[model samples]
Target: MISISETSTQRLRALAAATAAALLLAGCGTAEDDAPTDTDVSASPSAISLPVTPVTIELVDPGAEPRSSLTYEPAGEQSVVLTTSSTVSQQIDDQAAQDFSTPEITLPLTAQAPESDAGGEIRLRIGTPTSADQRLTEALAVAEGSEAGLTVTDTGAVTALSISPNADAEDAARAAIEQALNQAVYRSISFPSEDVGVGAVWTTEQQVVSGLTLNQTTTATLRERDGDRLTIDLRIDQTPESATLELPDDAGQLAIDTYTMSGSGTLEFDLGRSLPVSGEVTVAGEQQYSDPEGTTVLRQDISDTLRWSTP
Candidate 1:
């Protein structure tokens, strides 16, 4: 029989490759000079009304980028496309008082994926600046641990990312902080269009491959304007899919079986802040795999929520 340890090692490497590909992005903010400012909104005490005509989605906001850890080529065809769907919601409480002076933000997040795949429904709460730095420190520890089979470090990046940058943290701590900082910077997508009016539609597509043979075609439509907020509808056409496996050294001819997956959701972007307030998405599908061992089946019925708020 194949060594279980070897199999685990190979599987982890494959998953890591797939993850990196799916989370492709450029670097993010690091210097104290990179702090974010509240542009595109009203400075007055009262809330401002929605903008007229077309509106654009800012992709380079200092503090509003999504975070990622892994890095790889975009997913491609003749590979697996791992699909992800999200349903995020946001609400503003006018009655509750909040301090606008702080740069901190708390975002609630959830995710679900198949076991054979590299995903499971995970519920996580993330806070910006310090909390974000701390979480990265923990993850970095795992990645650099002797048993973690790693040999990389970036402690300085962690210090730079912290609300209180600490250049003195250990190598593992810094590496983790940098990793977290990278992800946050990547989330801030740079979209085009000066103004997107009601009924206007936009699409974001990538020809790069992250690992899986798949599509990431997404369409967003300006659905409605309810006073201070704008509702946007979204549809995902493909997900990242790819697999790295270790077959018997002398294994013969091989065959692969694939399946179908699809999903839809909505995003609530605040007209005032021009940021996604909240939204929800649901995705369902089934997949099958086979080999000399016989056959294996996988099914996915996953849903998730994303919310953003501040006072």
Candidate 2:
């Protein structure tokens, strides 16, 4: 008879829970807002705590002449919808690989800004996610009425974040939502401090931790500009910070043999709104993990889109 340690069982459960959440919620980016209204509530303390990493933005090109400063100003109550879809495949040892794809998911959200003039804080209320796939819909039903709060700078840098799951949400559901939200926050763009015009180019560098610690770098180019509205192109790349990863609950350590992740997308942004007007990002990567038991390989392909329309 084969026996598994209690710690190994716990780690397996955690991995399973994360996998379930990834199926229902897979995407990136934030939504738009409406008009400005006074928000009397103070910034809530951050519920998700992770090590802070400084984000550095460097301007490569200011674009053609007639450049101007780009900034974010709080717009009052607004409504927008977000949609996402993804596919993942995995194989272990000599086992046959499997592929899974999720139906398109649509999420409606409302964003509110604080009363302060600095306009550094924004609160978001997310409605239930729905999908045409009955199986996915049934799974997402438990996350109805989830809420997320974020603190961002004028340049759109996310500093702090929190997620409030529904009271009846299961542990797996909560884990999935948190993972999705974290991706959205880290994938958000931060602008350069200098003035820029159409054709402007810049790069942002930071470190992010989800299941693995990664060095994330994004390069953005200004594609178009019409007064307060702008279109930007983005390219993202990620690499592991180290070659070895320690499993949770002391399940064991795995040596990372190969890791690569990259994506490209475009974002429509408005300075007057709290979030992007519309955007789509597609990412694909393959990673190999090795342990005494053998080798496991995971390959994931993800595509996310965010759309905003006035309510």
Best by lDDT: 2
Tens-place lDDT per residue, model 1, 146-174, is: 11001111100011112122323454443
Q: After superposition, how far is residue 66 of candidate 1 from its true place, in Å?
A: 33
> Candidate 2: where are CA atoms >4 Å away?
1-53, 99-104, 117-119, 132-136, 292-311
lDDT of each: 0.31, 0.63
Instruction: Tell me how many residue pairs clash in candidate 2.
Output: 3
Regions of model 1 farther than 4 Å from truth: 1-196, 207-209, 226-229, 239-256, 271-274, 282-285, 291-305
TM-score of each: 0.39, 0.78
The residue-by-residue lDDT of candidate 2 on 37-101, one tens digit each, is 23323432213332235689999999998999997775787676666555555544445555544
- Number of clashes recorded per candidate: 45, 3
Shift of residue 199 alpha carbon in model 1, Å: 2.7
lDDT of 1: 0.31
What's model 1's TM-score? Answer: 0.39
